[model samples]
Target: MRVGKKLFPYPVLNNSKNNSGFGDSNYQLMITITQNENYFIIEKAYVEVENQDIERMLADGRAKAIMVVECSATVFREKYEIGIEPKDISIPIGNLNDKVEISSFIYANQDIEHFNSNDFLEDFADFDFSIEKYDILAVDDGYTTKVVFDEDKDKKMSSIFSVIKSNNKDLNVMTVSSENKQIVIEMPSQYFDYHDNMKHNDNFQNIFFAIIAIPALTQCLQEIKECFSDVYSMDINEVMNDKTWFVSIANRYQAVFGTELTSDEFIDCNTYEVAQKLLNCGSTKAIEDFYNLLWNGRSDSDDE
Candidate 1:
């Protein structure tokens, strides 16, 4: 499989002087795009303000500023249509000059199941096969990258495994532990081989391609973990402590992302550390933030 595109380097903005009546301060924003199959994911969008700017903004021990990142996409057809504009997703910047990274993805209608399975298939069933691709536009730092994915096929758990196995014949497949759970395959040898080759050749493009493909299998593994956890009345943490349980988690991660974890990568790490690292790499911050924002109150503060 060909790696799609190389992301451009981040553009650094240095706003130091008052131009056209704005403030006179030195601030920098670096924005970069990271692509996956269906999403134009934002790898890093960080803003840095000078200490002087922070000091100037801080008044009465409180300095509140909102940093917004808005995203939009376009769907092309006989009649071109623009997708809904994403909310003014804002993050609060306190009185600190430290770089704050904001990460998100621009998802197309095809990213959703209803659109992919029904709407798109019905609308463009007869069009030229090549022209049926949809584009997802991600706007960051006044630059946009159009991410394209084919709407003809749904990228299910089975399809992903088929592709991987077809590409690498040495893959040793293992079934997920839970019945009724989605298929989570393991290819420890193949994973190691791919990583070694990437390292040897120093192919960052292939490395990123592997990174993007991982989330697909990870989703399947997550379902299996949840099912197993519920059936056994054990937390993921407890399950991960045991070799079998750790293998299960690792298999799930590998299935989705096409990367196998070394024993050092998972077995050595504590439960919380492993979970945190997984959350960070998997782009599951929205789930964490929702819980923190909505349910965490006075009792939550006490627990913290």
Candidate 2:
């Protein structure tokens, strides 16, 4: 199935401008969202695990590893949190099946729970694995495009990079590994921080959707629909319209003045008047700030 809700991109590395090469702290915490059936699994689980340690685990039969998952809500803000599961589940503790795809990039594949212990390690070839998606937002960095997936694939996706880096010359992205099944993206880390500036609200579902899932995500979805619609079937249009792909701009028109509301309540209204009335009740200033944040990627701007 397609990714259900808006995904909080995995391994949000907050880079310090002081160091060109991000230190150990930057790589320690990896966050991600994966769609499991009806709900989205928000995974903020990571550990500074060593390779040899991971190898040792494989030798044992447990086939399980430690992980820290804060199963919080991403898109459905007022709805649910991980559905009956604890919000802050401790590390070395996550759904084993879910961690298989992402562990390669983080713990270097040691966290993966192979079905067949004997045959699993033997079949650990890189390219042999099936398709996976990744998004990387390189925060205020220069362009370094190392596809790491395929040489030719890198060349083909050059236009995608061009689309993302169109307006800003200052924020260029280098190589982010996509082989681990993620939609890796790069953006200024301030976007992740709550107190960054025009952040009237702490929630960033809209901003993340706009900035990270742009031409890259939509383009990938388009290609998948065209090529595999007949083979691996899905309702491409329905999922795409899940507000996860909506391009939100901070405009007075879209805002409803004097209302404290959530997105679910907005979506559930019946009549045009109800919807319009709802829109007329929200904080226009917050929307304006969000708008600037999404497009400009600067929370602390002179506009507000």
Candidate 3:
């Protein structure tokens, strides 16, 4: 049927006996927009009936009651229509919460030339439109992931401590306590052996240490392998075999030292080479033997 405007009426009941024999009844129409978008819109409108006047009208032989609805859309490119039916409208009286709800659907002719025209542009130029709810989904696969590396300064400094301790047993490395989320290393005398080591080898080892602190180590390793194929010739399987490679290295250091260092305490790439050399030569024992070397007693004959 061609869309046309029509009033859907409801009957009222009469309870009061008056000289005029008419009931004092009242009705109210309430309209609300629930959801709307570019293609289609849905709205809810209601009618309310109340009071004795409305009841008296229904008691009389009046078979119909009519309600007038008025609506307009800002966008002229889309033709909006309204539908009304007795089943679609309701009349509830007495209860403040009682309501008759009407549903409306506003659709556009997609094949029309003015489907998205600018006919209403000037009128609602500054109006802001918003939707209450929506759903979006990606139907196909293929997505990109990103990796970012922001160095943790505290971890870097902890690594430096482990590196220094691995080299010298007599050197005391002082660390300052901080309330903020930062690591501060303090030396009683800035002339500590560790500082001397850093001063001499900072250029080469800093880059190595930074790599170990990469946040996404797996991706970082892959990218490094691709870029430096010749330098990093180990296959991914061999590199990832913790039991055969990493554990063996850790065992070697522990065997020489008589004490095992925790994973976090173990020196990182920056000091790995130097630490290996020290462990190989028993530098830790040599540092402890300095007093014995200095205080070795003269021969008995020379004392005589």
- Score candidate 3 by TM-score against the native: 0.16
Instruction: lDDT for model 3, please.
Output: 0.28
Encode model 2's per-residue lDDT on 98-140: one tens digit a residue: 2122221222222232211121222232322221222221121
Candidates' TM-scores?
0.21, 0.20, 0.16
Which TM-score value belongs to model 1?
0.21
**Candidate ordering by TM-score (highest first):** 1, 2, 3
| Model number with the top TM-score | 1
Candidate 3, 120-182: lDDT as tens digits: 124333333321111100000111111111234332222222221223345454433321122
* Model 1 lDDT per residue over 1-304, tens place: 1012323121111232321111233344345555444444443444444434233322222232222333222212111111122222222221111122232212122322211111112333333221111222122223322232345644432233322222455545532232222233444566645744653332232222234324434444455455554565544443333322343455546764577755334333344434434333322443343355567621111110
lDDT of 1 at 158: 26
User: Which is better, 2 or 3, measured by TM-score?
Assistant: 2
Candidate 3 residue runs with Cα over 4 Å from true position: 1-131, 134-173, 176-183, 192-194, 197-304
Maximum-lDDT candidate: 1
Answer with 1 or 2, whichever has the higher TM-score.
1
